[model samples]
Target: MKQGLEPAARFAADLAAVWPEDERSGSLGLAVSGGPDSLALLLLAHAAMPGRIAVASIDHGLRPEAAGEVALVERVSGERGIPFTPITVKVAPGNVQARAREARYAALAQWARAQGLGAVATAHHADDQAETLLMRLNRGSGLAGLAGVRSRSTIEDSETILLRPLLGWRRVELAEVVAAAGITPAYDPSNANADFDRVRIRQALAEADWLDPVQLAASAANLAEGWQALSWYAELDWHEMVMRDPDAHGGLGFTYCANVPRVIAIETLLRIIGELGGHATRGEAARAWERLWAGENASLGGVLAVPSVERVEKVGVAMRVWRFRPEPPRSAGH
Candidate 1:
């Protein structure tokens, strides 16, 4: 019942609506980076759910200041009697931002598993969602991509779920929460760097008079609903119109009737490819569908689709079937 803890309580209620009450009964992992947003989350989560939270800060080792930031978060967590763990991750040699993100989540997931925590929460706010939407739109993303960052997602291949409870709050609101808590948060210099696409988009959105973060986030939520509806129907179609090809020898595969809708066909193919240890991008799936419709064989991303005829017993009819299979691996020299 602290004076500045109202926002945290409000967010706690918001999280409760999404998460089961039993799930929140256990200790939750909070990803605190000591930035204004994460720091605010640390304070708010502490106020809302006392004695049920542990904190961790990831040091990507990209900058010298990262260690100090982790130290700051550790101190804050210690002062509140919360368990604190600091993790250092080595970034791989590609796409610094993306690699760092992957490493960060991996480390967090590992730490959370060790601690027996159920879910890890981050401080992605409305502005972050807006920036993500704008970036995906600029890249010509489809409906699923345009849905932007989800509020809850499984961390890669890990069972640990990621929760973003602050997506409904704005950046400025988080700053206000930090100020009200009388805590000084560390700032990362790279947030203002124009070399990063997200930073540039954030700057542009700041200068625009008509654009609002809340509205942009709402649009993303609407698109997420649309994406969900598509997925629902896709799964329905998968169950109704597709079946496993039991006679396949090389790898597991599926077959669908030629009369299936294009969207359903593409979704079913993508699901099959995913199940067979391969991935097909949206464009690849669409092109494969076009090839199947034209009665041509197509192969991409280690999956192959070809047209075949199946004889129906007792019906005396040869029905067209689109057979999908995983491609055989190439030799080293090839």
Candidate 2:
């Protein structure tokens, strides 16, 4: 009994760090896909909170085995006396994994809202984080991409908060936990498919025995904190140095004050791209700023960037200014 209590107590501590006790008073939703990681999460959640949790098995309908997997989760949750919800979602076209993920969260958000649950928890673990970091690094992703998965955040644009208390747990540890409970986890065929980038990365990480996934996950978490701090400062810069342009093209203008740091400018320009319904990579934003600073015009993600110097009578000086607006539609002949 003491041995069982120890793991539960530790899991509870991890949960409290992300989802406070006061926040867990209401029912918490658990995403259980019948995989070993999520099954361990289910067992841990049941052990920690007992009656205050519900289980959700999302069936993407991509494979026939998904139904059996959902049924397994339902049976396990029923054995523990926890409420279970089986949600079937339609995966949108294009990028099967990405669309499936989007649909999964959307369904979970809708279910949680209707159920009035306090928060939803998933089973993203440390190994998953390391894989994500490596994948992003391979693609030359910037800070935001390398930050990996956040422990706690809102689901998409919804108010329902999502939690990942198992970020500190390792894949083998989770598999052991489930095995010790005498439960067989359903294996997803896609996990073994080498066509997926994550599967390939996981295989590579397995071969490199010297690399530590826990340390890599810790680095990703540290990067996440640094990104958040930079973002806060960027907001201040945005408010101080950025203004909405009155041009009919619906543009944004930034005053390139003498003291503006390159980091702040890059972050703020990324914000401008998001606000204008365009997506700009961090490298693209930095290059745009560099060109504008050199008195050259640049275009990025369907937005035109032009730099100029403007005289202001109130300030009694000329200030460097960068204007960003939607690029005009090109003529058909051209």
Candidate topping lDDT = 2
Clashes found in each candidate (C-alpha, N, C closer than 3 A)? 0, 0
lDDT of every predicted structure (CA atoms): 0.85, 0.87
Per-prediction TM-score to the true structure, in the order listed: 0.90, 0.90
Q: Give lDDT tens digits, candidate 2, residues 137-247.
A: 999887888899999889997999999998888899889889989999999988999999999999999999998998899999999998898889888978877777757
Candidate 1: minimum summed lDDT over ten consecutive residues — where?
Answer: 1-10
237-263 per-residue lDDT for model 1 (tens digits):
777667788553545787776555676
Score candidate 2 by TM-score against the native: 0.90
Q: Which stretches of candidate 1 lie over 4 Å from their true place?
A: 1-5, 248-251, 258-261, 308-320, 328-334
- For candidate 1, give the lDDT: 0.85
